[model samples]
Target: MTTNRTVQTAADAALWLAVHRGWHVLPLNYGTKRPLGGCVGCRADNKPDHTPQTCPCLARGDGALCHAVWAATTDPEVIRRWAQRWHTSVWAVHLGVSGLLAVDLDTRPDPPPHQPLNGLPWPADEPPPADGLDTYATLAALSGGTVGTDTFTTDTPSGGLHLLYEAEALRWKGSHGKPRPGDDTVRTGLGWQIDIKAYGGYVVLPGSTSKAGLYRRSSTTTTPRPLDPWLADALTRTGHDRTAAPDARPAAPVPVLDAQTGPARYAASALRSACAELAEMEPDTGRNRKLFRSTTRLAGMALAGWIDRTTVETALAEAARHAGLPAAEIRYVLASGFGRPLAVPDIRSAA
Candidate 1:
């Protein structure tokens, strides 16, 4: 019996080590969950064998390392010792990361998920950050010569530029951008923003509509034209030519919502689902590109639902309030996309 007890002790220690290494150790405290917190640099919460020297913080490491040491040690004295040491502003990093989660929980609000792109184009690589207008302009200029112009046309309160071009012209501009979406910002490099619809096609600047400008798509392959021929000829030519027909409406989302209520329900559902899916699609470290298309799909769904003036206006007000976005030119996103009615959520609701 004594020998068996010794062997059992050894096995328990081995299992604990395995658990620290992320080997899926079974629960020891019955209902108690595994430790979820850890050192950010070395992932100490998930890794147990890490020593103080191996601690990513020790080589100039800080509170993250301290929390990690306390986290890894089972001894109460050691835990207390490390907890007392290595405390500082760096602790704020851990708190900041965890605080975001805590605030989301306490506020019972879903903050806009972290958008990992430099904002600078007709179609933003990421959702614009709060107070993002100035940064957005700088980022937009990076693509200045690529395929489109960044100018705002809306007369709203906040001023920002929109990318303008004929429906046929945007295709060339999106493909030629530098440090572009998915490549420079998100680092997944899977795809770039492609405009599939034609209409007002205005990108809104965040702060003041009065300052909003417009941009037309251009290409290095061909010399850039000042404006669409229809607009240019109307300004220059004497005779009216009916050769270019008005832009046609692109295909709409299937089972489009007609009523305002239907679209509202759809947009809310899509936004929540998209955020949940984004969390799942990217690794915790946030190294993934699939999120772009996934986010675009959400935006597309929202834009489709926006077709109803009442639904979009209401939802936009809510999303803006929740996101802390300024009211200036918020609806320009809808104008830029193919206006379609969202059908999926509405149909599902009926069922």
Candidate 2:
């Protein structure tokens, strides 16, 4: 929140971030978000399987700045040494080390006509969002929350927005390093143009210049606000909470099949049981396999005309989501399960 000091260079920015904000800082290649290539001994060709955990470079503490964000440090002396070594380098803040979570809202062309953006279902009464900002607003509106204007916000070179929030108490899997194939633009499961930077992730600090332009503060407040409750709920719902565990109660109550009997009742009962099991699964503990199995069973029932495919999909999707599987993963597992040959016995025969 301190604004007394001026940041004239990347080193200055890094120092301010470390001294003023207590954020862990790293050196990024000038004009790019990439970390400087590893030192000779740590290069990929020298050691293809090299990792910071196993490499001797990190232990040496020689201020080599190897292993990208893994080498982020708040030590002023080390940062100053980095400034001398990589004079033109920009600054990057290691989000996890700094206990920050940044919501990156990107600007891009809307999806082509007819195809849903990120295959996400939009509200029936509202038009699809045009960009990450719009998508964020839509999400906030849906969650009975407002877009936080008081948080620490920054504007990227490409006219995108970065909303930084305190996330010291929360932890999630994954990183914001390199983009995966076909996922370069929008982050899967979160939204169309929004990306989350959390554990194992880093964000370019404000005042750092890149190829496009400067990353500058856009908010009046310089400090990151506490994570909004609604936004936290959204993150949890979208599988961003790795700490989530199975609770005593089911995620959702099993609907009563009051009007159904015979084969229909059997199919509904199977679905209810599957959903219950899914809702109680532990994180990273074969949730995908469980979802696929349930999907396959319910899919077979749908194929046998004892249950509706849409009904099966909706219920299973909700259950899997509650189990902390991301939306994209849920869809992929469902597709795979549905593609398999029908293997379930006819409900009438079972009855």
Error of 1 at 300 (Å): 2.4
Candidate 2 residue pairs that clash? none
Off by over 4 Å in 1: 1-260, 280-289, 307-350
lDDT accuracy of residue 341 in candidate 2: 34
> What C-alpha lDDT do the candidate models reach, one value each?
0.29, 0.73
Q: What TM-score, to 2 decimals, does candidate 2 have?
A: 0.65
lDDT of 1 at 184: 26
Clash count (model 2, backbone only): 0
lDDT of 2 at 338: 91
TM-score of 1: 0.18
Global lDDT of model 1: 0.29
Backbone clashes under 3 angstroms, per model? 26, 0
